[model samples]
Target: MDERVEAVLRDGRAPGFHGLVVMRGGEVVLERYGAGPDHRLGEPLGHVTFGRDTLHDLRSVSKSVVALLYGIALGDGLVPEPGAGLTAQFPEYRDLAEDPGKAHLTIEHALTMTLGLDWNEDAPYTSPANSEIAMELAPDRYRYVLERPVAEEAGKRWRYCGGATALLGGIIARGTGRPVEEYAAEALFGPLGITDFAWTKGGDGVASAAAGLRLRPVDLAAVGQLVLDGGRGIVP
Candidate 1:
């Protein structure tokens, strides 16, 4: 066991870190907890507690969950195929793909992160030149991300496209005819009893698909239990 968690916590550095649990066939075979500093890492200090209902930032976990949502939408006959065009849901992007080559990109390319759009994720938001910074500065973030110039031939190579997930959230919203939160509430969280979470709204009024969600540690464990049951316990 990586009990190093205890030593780290003793040194007062174990804040924000969490433990892991594994269950197979509804049986918990592995359980481990880490001692870390409290989840709240800023002023207005918060207490270090566990096994409580709280929604701490999952960082990139939101991306994984969003992928699940995409799969569910696809299975539910909401989205036809990954080959769907960017302009399919948002026709406004039709003008942006002025290059015939750019028009070849599909939702699958974006999902697989092969869109080849140059976005400096680590760039300082203060820099006006950063694609994300510029997008935030734009009056419409949806349009901003949509119009970003293609950096490489689509589907040529894989790149980590965080924005792609956000765009997918918009696609989901468009498909369901509702906002991401509402769609998630109706489809994902509501059934799972994941009642507590927060999402950052962008200028286009959408949740941050990259890192918008928080989850209860125990609730996450219950998610494993649900999965171990194989498509049962999702609702009712």
Candidate 2:
């Protein structure tokens, strides 16, 4: 609608930028889409001419959505509270839970990404060296995360760890007796009228709660609107 928007549409700025949707007082103010290359998970999808119907990967934005879903599931009493012991929720990892060093770890620590675990995402996502990619390649993602050497005391500091989101997704699935995507559909997306979306999963079929969500620009805007609306329709 303006020179800046026109420049973005031409890909002269933010080359891979796909779309934008702005709303004010729950009313659409401006909306735009553009042509760009896209990928599913990490696989190339070629160039795409995006529009209202086309789904765009949210990447790390998926983490925020997972957090919202966690809150919703918690409100339904389907997941553990923040104060609950982290490893205690995964009884299969008995030895890890028994570790006195990790005894201070709680769900709150994971929620806030303050578990102080030894994690590394400094590598490119395509590299196996990345902690997230390594988690996906592991036999058990939860154990891969929970077994990481403690870098510091839990809740002592905040750190960026996709493993934390994966653990939260596991907890939600374990408690709701359903996958994160399935629970999201029933509890969040459906209420928000987001019908067309894709959640990429790992080789083990678990959704990449860290960075796998895809939604159209308009629908993604609706999600932002929900947060602005104090989560009135879905989250508690």
Candidate 3:
């Protein structure tokens, strides 16, 4: 290990940092874990001792996995072209179809986070005002996302909208006739030999495409390796 890297890890350990993995040339060059008590909102839940088999929450990292699955869906012809209008796929959302701005939204917009919906995630996760929290609490998660007031024309600007990812998950479920997690297992994870993992779902029973996935760090590193391999044989 490089001295500078060692110094940084030493510093990170004091602040509840858990694990770090570094890969190069499709190989793990460094892997380390630190000891600390894992807590939720300042409440000490229990001590965490990380290891090779530890399943860590991927959080927003799941978004990347969702993106990969979308690619697979595209290859399998399960979804329409990127230019396809979002409203066309979910005609049941009659209210959204009437809104010209949202009606014009595209799969490209959702994938790029350019839906231009007014979303505020700057607040802490515990805050009800957080767009993500609000979406999670809504009765109809898809409707909650689709009904968000348009802040700008679709694809005109960038905004971090967890709702958009939720919509994408719904689209995946609709297109493939399977839950996002199931689709991923057959399409991506199975090929990658990633068998042990967890994907959380929203109230709608669809996987949370925005931020809910858990995997061992070693398996997560395999995802990186897959990318470095130019996505060879991972899809199709």
Number of the top-ranking candidate, with lDDT as the measure: 2
Question: Backbone clashes in each candidate structure, one number apiece?
Answer: 4, 0, 0
Q: Scored by CA lDDT, what does every candidate get? A: 0.66, 0.91, 0.81
- Judged by whole-model lDDT over C-alpha atoms, candidate 3 comes out at 0.81
Q: Report the lDDT tens digits of candidate 2 across residue range 1-236.
A: 66678776566776776888979899888887777799988999999988889999999999999999999999999998999999999999999999999988988998999999999999999998999999999989999999999999788888899999999999999989999999999899999888888999998889999999998889888888999999994899
Residue 145, model 3: lDDT of 79
- Which candidate model has the greater lDDT, 1 or 2? 2
Best by TM-score: 2
Put the candidates in lDDT order, highest first.
Answer: 2, 3, 1
List pairs with backbone clashes in candidate 3.
Answer: none
Cα RMSD for candidates in order: 4.2, 1.4, 2.5
Ten residues in sequence with the least summed lDDT for candidate 1: 36-45
Using alpha carbons, what is the TM-score of model 2?
A: 0.96
lDDT of 3 by residue, 11-83 (tens): 7745666778888777788887766676432235588887877777787888888888888898889988889
**What order do candidates take by TM-score, descending?**
2, 3, 1
